[model samples]
Target: MRRKGSPHLVVIASDPADAHFCNVELRKLKTGAIVGRHYILRSDVQTFVSMYRRDGFSPVEGGNND
Candidate 1:
C-alpha cells in the first residue's frame, strides 16, 4: 500500500534463477531503489505485469495496495 506524499511506482518481476528461494524483484518505477528482497510466487508474474501496464502505473488499482 501507499501513503500520502509517498508517490512512487512498484514494479514486481520474477527473480533470477540464481536466487536461493522463490522471490520477486520490487523496484520503484522512475527511481533507483535497490530491489532484491521481496517475495511472491513466480506464477503470478503475468497477472502482476498485466495489471501494472493496464493501470498505467497510477496510484490506483494495481499500483496501490489499497
Candidate 2:
C-alpha cells in the first residue's frame, strides 16, 4: 500500500545474478504499479542520491530508509 502525496520512486534488485545492479522505478501512488523503470549500476547509485538531495527529496514517515 502507498500513502498519498508520497514519493513514487522505488529501487530494487531485479536479478539475483546482478545484485549490484538495481531498477529505479516510478510507480503510481494509488495503485502501487510501476509506470517507468530504468536499470542503474551500483556505481551510479550515488548520482541518484545526490540528485534527490539537490531536489530536496526526503523520506516520508514509515517509509523505508535503507
Kindly list the per-residue Cα lDDT of model 2 for residues 14-36, writing each as its tens digit.
44578677666667666879887
How does residue 27 of candidate 2 score in lDDT?
72
TM-score of 1: 0.38
What 10-residue stretch in candidate 2 is worst by lDDT? 1-10
lDDT of 1 by residue, 1-66 (tens): 222344444545435674432443445545747454456565665566566557554334664232
Model 2 reaches what TM-score against the true structure?
0.62
lDDT of each: 0.48, 0.60
Residue 56 displacement (Å), model 1: 1.7
Clashing pairs in 2: none
Cα-lDDT of candidate 1: 0.48
